[model samples]
Target: MYVPVSLLFFFIGTALFVYYKTQPGLLPETVTGDQVFPYFIVNGLPAGFTGLLIAAIFAAGMSTVSTSINSSATVVLTDFFNVTSHSEADEKRKMNILHATSVILGALGVGVGLAMMSVKSALDAWWSMAAIFSGGMLGLFFLGYIARGIKGSYAFVGVICGVLLIAWMSLSRQTVFHNYLTIVLGTLVIFTVGMLLAIAGSRLKKGN
Candidate 1:
C-alpha cells in the first residue's frame, strides 16, 4: 500500500513541479520546496476549495495527533503503571490514569509544536528527532530478534553502545553520517555486539 501510494504521490508531485516550472512567473526563485504546495494551494486554487482543503488538512493532522497521544498514553500505562486485567476498581483507576496521561501528553505535544514554529522545515526537524529517538528503540528490537543466549548484561551493553553512537552521530556536527542512517547503524551495532558477546560467552564457558 505504501509503495504504490508513494509512487503515485511521486508522479503527482513531479507533475506539479513540471507545471509550475513550465509556466512563466508562476513560481518565484525565493520560494522553497516546503512552501511550494502551500503557495500553490493558496494562490492557484479557488478560495472556497482552498478552505475545504485546508480543513481536510487539519482533520488529517488531528487524526494523527490523536493517535500519537493515545499510543503514548498506553505506553505510559503499560510501562509505568503496569496496568493489567484486575478488579473493576483497578480497571477504573487505570482508565483514569490513562485519561490523565492523554491530557498531559496532548498539552506537551501542543507545546512542542509551538516551539517548532521557528524551524525552517518542520519535516526536517521531525526526521531528526525521530531518528534520534528511534535509534535506541530499533537497536533494542534488533538485539532481541537476532541474538540467542545473550545475557542481559551483554544486551544492555550493546544497547548502551548503540545509543551512544546514535547520540554522537546526531549531536556531533563533524560526523559524516546522515540523520536517517542513525537508526540503521544503531540497530546493526546492537545486534552485532550482542551476538558476538553471546558467542564469546559460550566459547569461554566451554573452555572453562
Candidate 2:
C-alpha cells in the first residue's frame, strides 16, 4: 500500500513539475502548494475527469476529518477521562462525554482552520506545526522504548527539554536542518538527555 501510494505521488509530482516547466507563465511567482491541485483540476483535467477528481478530493478530505475526529475522541476518553476516574463510569455517561469532547474538538478545529485561512503555504505551515506538536510525544515514546531503566522523572525532564529545543529551533528558523527534521532532532535530544540523566541518577543513588 505504502509503496503504491508513494509511486503514485512520485508520478503526480513529476507530472506537476513537467506541467510547470512547460507552462511557467500560467502560475504567478507567489503560487502556493494549496493552489497546485485546484489549478491542475481546473486546467489540466478534461471535463469528464475533472468531476471525478473533485469527488476524490472531497472523499479524501472527509476521510481525514473523520479519522482525526475519531482519534481525538478516543484519546480524550481513554487517556484523559478514563485515567482521571476512580471507578468505571456508566456507559451512557461515557458516551456523552465522548460526544461532548468530539464536539469541542470539532469546534476548535474549525476555529483554527479559519485562523489559518490566510496562510501563504498551507502545506509548509501544517508540516512545521505538526513537527512541533509531535516532538515531545515522539520523544517520550522513544525514551521509554529505547532507553531501558530510564526513570519517569528523567523522562519528564527530557520531554521538557525537547519541547524547549523544538521551540527555539522553530522560532529561530535555524538552517542547521530543514523544518521537517526538527521532530527527529527533538526526539534524539529527549532520548539522549533522558538516558544520561537516568544513568547519572542511578550512579548517585548507588554511591549513597
Best-matching candidate per TM-score: 2
- Please give each candidate's TM-score: 0.78, 0.82
In candidate 1, how many Å is residue 96 off? 3.0
Which stretches of candidate 1 lie above 4 Å from their native place?
A: 1-5, 83-92, 136-146, 178-181
- What would the per-residue lDDT of candidate 2 be over residues 1-208, giving only the tens digit for each residue? 8689879976887788788989898767776576786787887779989999889889998899889998999899999989999999999998998899889989998998997888877756766676677779988988888876788899999988998888777757556877767888898889889999988998999999
Each candidate: what lDDT? 0.82, 0.84
Clashing pairs in 1: none
RMSD of 1: 3.3
